[model samples]
Target: MGEVIRVAVVGKGGSGKSTVAGTLSRLVARQGRKTLALDSDPMPGLALSLGLGHITEPMLTAAVEKDLNGRWQLKKGIGGARAVSQFSIEGPDGVRFLQFGKADELGLGTMFASVSGFGQVVHRIAEDGVLSDWSIIGDLSAGTRQTAYDWAPYADTYLVVVEPTWKSVLTGRRIVRLAEQRGAEHIHLIANKIESNGDLDVIEERMDLAARCVISRDPMVTTADAAGVALIDHAPESSAVASIASLAEGLEGD
Candidate 1:
C-alpha cells in the first residue's frame, strides 16, 4: 500500500455501493491502515454491511449543537480527529464507522442536526492535515445528489459502482459526469453484480467507459443481504468478496 485511500462509493439504489464501501474499508484496515467508513445515507446500509448490524442511534448526534443562529454545527473543540475518536463506532478489522441519523417515520427533519454535524466533520477531516494517514471510504446516498453537493471532498477517487442494468448505468453516468465536474482526479466505473461474461461489456458499452474492477453476481451476496449479515462474514470465501479485496489492493497500490 502506497498512498492513503480516500474514495466515495456511489451508485444507484441496490447497486451494492454499501457492500463495496464497507468491504473495502475493512480490507484496507486489515492491511494495518486506519480506515474510516462513512455512511451518508439517512437510511443507513453501511452499518449492516460493516457488520455493526443495525446501529439504532445516529453516531454523530452528540457531536453537534444548535448555535445562537439556530443552526446545527459541530460543537466547539470537536474537530475531525476528535470526532472520529469519540463518536465513531468500531467495527470488524478495526474499521471506524460514522453515519447520518437514520430517518424514522418522522423523516429526516428529526436528524438535521446530525446531518449538519456529519457534513462539518467530513469537510473538517479533508482540511485537517492531521488525519492525512487515515483511509476514508464514504458510501454516499444512492444517485447523484451527494456528488452534486460535494459531500466527498476528501475523495481523490470516486468509485462509481454500476450493476448490469440500464437504470444503474444511467445513474452511474450522471455521477461520473458530476464527479468530473467536481474535478475528481480519478473516477472509475466499478462493474458490480456481473452475472455473465457479457455483463461487464453491457455496462462498459452503456457508460462508454471501461470498468476498473468487476465483481461477480455471487448467490452468497444475495443470501447475506436477505439475512442482514455482512458479505465478508457470511461468505468470506465468496467470489464477490474476493473481487472487492482485489479492488482494495489495486487502490492501495495507487
Candidate 2:
C-alpha cells in the first residue's frame, strides 16, 4: 500500500462502521497524512461519529453544475483538490470532511442535487491524479445499495465491518462478495464489537473469512456516543480506539 489508502467502510447499520471510519481517518491524519473523511449516508451518522455533529447542509451542491446534456458535474475546473479546499469541512486532527446532504422530511428529494454532486465528486477523485497522495476514507450507507451501485469508486480496499450477530455477518459477507465482483484489489473483514475470543470466532466461522483486525466492545464507545463526540476525543486511550489506531497503522504502513 502507498501513503494514500482509499478505503470504503461498509456494513450493516449499527455495526460500528462509522466509528471505524471516523477514528481511522483521524488517526491517519495524526500520522501526518492528509486525510479526507467522506459521509455518503444521507442520514447524518458519520458526522456525529466524526464529532461534526448534525451537518445537515448539502455541501457539494455549489460545487456542481448542469452540462448541456443536463447532467450534473464538478463545474469547469473543480476537481478533487479544488473540491476539498472549497467544500470540505475541517475537523479535529486536521481531517477534512465532505458529505452528501441529509434527507429532510420530504425524503431524499430535497437533496437530490447534492447526492448527484457527491457521486460525481467521488468518481472524479478516483480518476483525477491531482490528489494521488491524499488518503480518502468513505463511510458508505448501510446495506448493499451503495456497494451494488458503485458508490465507492475511489476505494481500492473495502473494509467490511461485521459484528457477532448473524445479520451483521450476512451483510458483511454480501459486501465482500460485491467488492470481489467489482474487481477490488483488497477486501478485509473488520470484526467489530467483539466481546471476547468467542465473538471473534463466531464472526469468522459464520462469515467464512478471517478478520484483518478486531475492535473490542468497549464501554467507552457507548460513553462517547452518549456524549455526542468522537471516540478519539472521548477516550483516546480506550481499547476500541487502540484497535482502530492499529488498524489505521497497518493499512497506511502497508
Candidate 3:
C-alpha cells in the first residue's frame, strides 16, 4: 500500500559512488521515508560513510549456494525482501544498511553470489512490490561488474556518479547505456567532487548525459573523512551536504 523506489548508485572507481549512495539514502530518510542502503560492493564502503560498521545478520549473498551439479542457486534464508529488517543494520535517521558478502580477495564466487542476490531483489520487488515504503539505494561494485553481472534491473533507477575525468565520464556513459539495455526505467547522472564551475563545465562539455544533481567539492567532506564521522552530522551546512540533501525532493518523482 506504499511506494518504494530502488536506486542503485554506480560509476568508475574513485568516482565517489559510495559517497553519493550513502548521502542520498540519509537525505531520503530525513524526509520521513524509510530507506535501505544496500551495499552490493564487495569492498563494502557505504557502511562507514553512513557512520556505521558491522552487520547484525547474515549477508544477502549468503543465501546463494552451490547445488550438487555445481550450479549456484538461492536457498531460502534471505528470501522475502519484505523482511529485510531481520537482516539489515539500522543507520542514521531512517536508513538501514545491508552488504553482500565481504571478499578477502577478488574472485568469481563473491561476484556471482552478489549478482544472484540482486536478481532475487528484482524478482521479489517486481512480483509483489513487497518492499513498500522503503527506498532502496544500492552502492554497486565499481566499473562493469554490474554490467558483467547483468544487475541493472535490481534498481528501478540508477544514479551514475560522474566526476571530472575522462575515465569517469566514459564509464558513466557505458553504465547509462548498459542499464537502459537491461531495462532500467531511469538512469540519471550525479556529478560529484566538483571543485569549481570549471570542473562542472568539463563534465557538461564532453558528456551527452546531463547531471541531475551536482555535489560540490567541500573541505568539510575531507575533514569528515579523516575524522571518520558522518558528513551530515559532522558538517550539516557544508556545500556537499546541502547539494545532496536537495536531491531528496525529486527522488521518487521520476
Pick by lDDT: which candidate is best?
1
- For all predicted structures, in order, the TM-scores are 0.96, 0.94, 0.85
RMSD of each: 1.4, 1.9, 3.1
Can you rank all candidates by lDDT, best first? 1, 2, 3
Better of 1 and 3 by lDDT: 1
Measured on C-alpha atoms, candidate 1 has an lDDT of 0.90
Over 4 Å off in model 2, which ranges? Answer: 68-70, 105-110
- The number of residue pairs in model 2 that clash at the backbone is 1
- The models' CA-based lDDT, in order, is 0.90, 0.87, 0.74
Candidate 3 has its poorest 10 consecutive residues by lDDT at 53-62
- Per-residue lDDT of 104-153 in model 3, one digit per residue for the tens? 54356666775566567655655666666667888888997776565534
What is the alpha-carbon lDDT for the whole of candidate 2? 0.87
Best by TM-score: 1
**Sort order, TM-score high to low:** 1, 2, 3
Instruction: Note the residue pairs that clash in candidate 2.
Output: 1-254
